[model samples]
Target: MGSAGVRLGRLKANTSALFVCDIQEKFRGLIHGMPAVVDTASRLVRSAEVLEIPVFVTEQYPKALGNTVAELALPPKALVFEKTKFSMCTSDVDKAFRKMNLDGIGQVLLCGIETHVCVLQTVLDLVEKHNVEVHVCVDGVSSQRETDRSVALRRLQGLPNVFLCTSEMAMFQLAGDSKHPKFKQISALAKEKRPDQLSAL
Candidate 1:
């Protein structure tokens, strides 16, 4: 990570948002460790709610790929968008960001499916295009194959503006202090063991 990225590293609830990309129903059977991805992603979503961090979700060609998995208990206020692009930073997504008045938001917590594709592209765009600091939850993202996921993570690490992290790590950082009002609730979410498949990765 670059110095600038580290300088803005603290994940304040007010300036951070969660972006869940393309964790759709059609990918459930095909993606590696689908169950684990959903579990971690859901935990992050719930934690974000506790922190009062806004959540954004995207569906890549929802009509063809189906909607986001039923397992993710998306909040009623979450912004859900449909897109044909691999990157979540599409026109629709941009409009949603503007609509949400995210001009001052500086950090993006990213998760979801096909790490080598949609997730990878989205992270790159968020950094290169929007100039936002991005934290990627490794346990909450996957590909159809382990090698692909590994490669994508490696590439992401090379980006100065992108920080590779686990869901638990990000949540704790967001919480910042043990005395934080939501710390207990958020800490409980991390008690669950990460999936063996993701652990091996």
Candidate 2:
């Protein structure tokens, strides 16, 4: 339920958190569209910081997969956790979510690597178990193979409480409109498009 406790068709700043999963060094050159994925993830992180939304990040088996890529520039306040499981739904994460839920956070904005694996599993746990509204950023998550990534996204689309969107779409949904206090900052973010995303003008 959202504003009127009927449909969750919007995202409120007070009810949102950002989740970045397994965008690590080991998979750098292995994942398809890695550059774009990192770009969108970075943008989302910056937006989350500006919007004062708590950030949750998980590194899958970091000892072997290595750490989150340096380019992501996670802030000092963002919760970064290490996990051996493919899903980011660890005890620690659940604890944090529980705390946030108490404070009215029921929406999750997710972006990260290996869409078919960690991202998919985490989405399942979030919707099925946590019972929170999940927004998966399409441009922000991917796998080594386009087919895997596409299939995972398609499956995720069908799941209840799971919303698929681009990074910018989530940002605007949070801000709501031009009158939002942080609208200017979000507009600036929307303008700074990556080269690949920019078209000839």
lDDT scores of the candidates, listed in order: 0.86, 0.88
Query: Could you give candidate 1's per-residue lDDT for residues 13-45 as a string of tens digits?
Result: 877899999999999899988998999899999
Report clashes for each candidate as comma-separated counts. 0, 0
TM-score of 2: 0.93
Question: Where in model 1 is the C-alpha error above 4 Å?
Answer: 1-8, 98-103, 197-201
Alpha carbon lDDT at 74, candidate 1: 95
Pairs in steric clash, model 2: none
Q: Estimate candidate 2's alpha-carbon lDDT, on a 0 to 1 scale.
A: 0.88
Best by lDDT: 2
Please list the Cα RMSD from the true structure of every candidate, rounded to 1 decimal place: 2.2, 3.1
The lowest-lDDT stretch of 10 consecutive residues in candidate 1 is: 1-10
Residue 18: error of model 1 in Å?
A: 0.3
lDDT tens readout by residue for model 2, 1-201? 756666554888889999999999999889888888888899899999989999999998889999999988999999999998889999999998888888899889999988999999999999877888899998888899888888899899888888888888888998888998889998898888673531100
